[model samples]
Target: MSQFKPRRPATGAAIAVLAIALTACGGPGGSQDEGAATLTFGVQAPPNSLDPAQLHDGTQRYVWGSLYDTLIYSDNEGELQPAAAESWEYSEDARTLTLRLRDDMTFSDGDPVTSEAVRVTLERTRDTAGPQQNNLGAIESVDTPDEHTVVLNLSEPDPNLLVALAFGSGVIGDPDTIDDESTALNPVGSGPYVLNREETVDGSTYVLERRDDHWNADAYPFETVTVRAIQDRTALFNALLTGELDAGTVDETQAGQVERAGFTLQRVDGISVGQIVIADRAGEVVPALADVRVRQAINLAFDRQGIIDAIFLGLGQPTTQIFNTLSPAFVEELNGEYEYAPDRARELLAEAGYPDGFTLTMPANLFVQQVQPTITQALADIGITVEWEPVPAQQSGQTTNWGMYFNLGAVAPPSRTVALYFEESGSQNPFGTTDPELDGLLEDLAAETDPEAANGIYREINAFAVENAWSAPIFLQSTNWATRDGVEYVGTANALFDIRVFALSR
Candidate 1:
């Protein structure tokens, strides 16, 4: 979900505290009963579609996650765990993966959730070229020898396949319910909840009713769930105060205020990295940015700590590398390589033949604007002139436009993050900068089956990217959510609020 700037009054925090106090006394209302087992979540945006293949945003996943089940589970640290699949093993050559499905699992449509179903789902995912196609692109074929056995044949060894399956890649749908075109609007899966079409109003509110006979009933305890999309943060916050919502996504800046209001605060590192994406590396519009030294200078000029303290209210850590800190590939030594140094930045600029620096356009978002003054000052100290351009609302997440734009977005696994942004052949890489050196390293990293060897390759990739300044990472921003009294929501490390687990206090 995109950040929504709050227009709170000077006494808004105090008002919120008092309002929450009154809410405790008054009890629940606005469609919630006093002791009802319903969880109404005020989301930032509505689901784009019900189909898992079409889902690309967190808001959509928040709903779809409840309605679909993946083959594998992800622990908070992103380690692979068991879910639908009972156990899985790799072949001796590490080029094939075999999974054993739970014998008792069944889809919501009353069909057995078998290995054949898994194969059908994965093959369908690959053929559809869905949002998660990259996650399953390495699979050459899927063969089901029995009802409970599925073997995946890979074109090459793919270390990310398991992680991808644990994430968006392994959403299994009922083969009987899916159609070629209409599945985007209608979804059928073996998950715990079923979408209530009668009560659901597209673009405004979505209602999900729990299935009593679901195999994973222990995970989802809520009787009824309602997801209401409120774009304005102020309005969403007010709804929480007025007992209109049991939980809502809150900004990191409002963490203290939410806690002060007696609401339970949920914090996580989120799936996305916060950074300044140098989209125009080829320098079509901003010619000076084409230099590697200039990009390195830009990387060194940011006060990441200061920005986190001021804008994120000390809720985030200064990002060290492109990979999330939780990933095994993360190199601790690379954390301070681009430490804030105006002197070094100036030196790098001079080395790049820009002793007096050059002018470049920068796209500004709400959060980016908060730290713009400090960033602008640092750039000016290093003889770089920045022209701030307000991001067009329609083009919020598009990278086709030139300039240093804020990348407040999601990329699940570290390997996929590298592939998506850095690789020349990556579908998401708009600039298409060809780097055979980085490409060769990524190729090796992709094919490596040994975890330790993969980590080493990742370190080499990190060293090359840091030395070349592929992109200037700011920090991994924190995602904050707040729940009313008597509600428990365990936030995921990926920062996804899995609605399947949301439950009211007994």
Candidate 2:
């Protein structure tokens, strides 16, 4: 079991200092037009990237809510249901799959959603000349048989295709919506929400109205939703407390204040692994964190309870295993490998030739505040010295990308994320680290359409990651947000607010 050490609200003086900024931090919600229905929401930060090709990170994760929609989506159980493609068929050869587009869709600007658009969108996913091209490498080609129909031929059979489509990046935007270097300020897509207005001055915020003509309107609720970029947590909470907002994201630590103030709080198990990446492995130099035991020392030193307390105000639980535990394809044993033990952690560091300990830097942000400090202090108990090197939210420094620092990526399929982050040609692998075996495993797994076989590949990769210490995982962030009375809750694993089905009742 992992112990947690939560970061309490800094002391009396700190709270007093924070209290003054509380209103700026603690925002008050606002109301929409009397009869015009737009659900006003709050976001802690603005999105980072608008280009679908290079979109990765928390802000881009939310951009998914406005600018795109995927071929498939998940219901509460996470089973792939339907989206752009109304229905699909797998060829007898099992390598070719046909997708039937819903003819009832159109871009909010009134451009018809043609089968040609589907072709362009997919081909873009696999085009070397395009962004995210390698992410679609497993796909051999996309052939459109006719309007309303597209046949995707894979290099091999892949059962995870359906799941992959539900991924945020899998969202299909208008070929025109993408410009020469980035996504157009006005992106058009067949998604349920249409971006009517975007204010980019202080921070970018969008005003979205539900599309009554949405391909799936009957299932959607809100007709209009306004998403406000509230960068500070305290401001976000204040807005929620004052009923100035309907629903949005919040930190787990503020759960107590939210409860004390009398508001409804709902949460789902975190599905994303908030991880710490280690680079610069040249075989035998102990690569900063080359040893699994040393990595374990870090993981064990993480006071899960301490984080829950100090950071989360004791609001969430320590995730014992990888988020794979909730994945349908995960095997029980792989989730078992990432367990915690502090004494054993000491033993491992001692075995790794660091009996007296060594100094290391932890690149941090909000996620780091939640765990790294505690992990740093815990490692100190066993004599490990750590300095928190804050990585700015700018382009990664060349040296740091190759040697130090960790950048966050929202949770998606293991194959999808690994393909983007660790593969030889993948953009996130700034360190030039490449394992052909690991790459091949990704290929084999992606090609496996069978849930069982694909799952085996994920397990295999996790085993490899544990042994190699590719990155040290802290814990999945448990997503929780709230709404005042009469506002329905729609919590998603990704924390996106699906405006269509949301309803505000007085």
Which candidate's lDDT is highest?
1
Candidate 1 structure, TM-score to reference: 0.80
Q: Write the per-residue lDDT of candidate 1 for residues 1-506, one digit (tens) a residue.
A: 11112234347687556434433432222234432357788876676666656655445676877788888776554556677786788876778888878787877778888887788889887777556666677799999999998889999777667766765678888777765465665588888888888998877788988777776664554668888988677899888777688888677766677788878877766346777777677777677778888888888888889878877777777875777777666777888888888899899889888888898777775446556777788789889887888863223333556656666665355665666666663434666777889879978886676668987887788778777777788787766768877676665655444674354543
**Pairs that collide, model 1:** none
- If scored against the real structure, what TM-score would every candidate get? 0.80, 0.78
Find the 10 residues in a row with the least total lDDT in model 1: 1-10
Pairing residues by index, what is the TM-score of model 2?
0.78
Off by over 4 Å in 1: 1-36, 57-59, 251-253, 269-272, 279-287, 342-350, 353-404, 410-413, 422-428, 431-434, 492-497, 500-506
Worst 10 residues of 2 by lDDT: 1-10
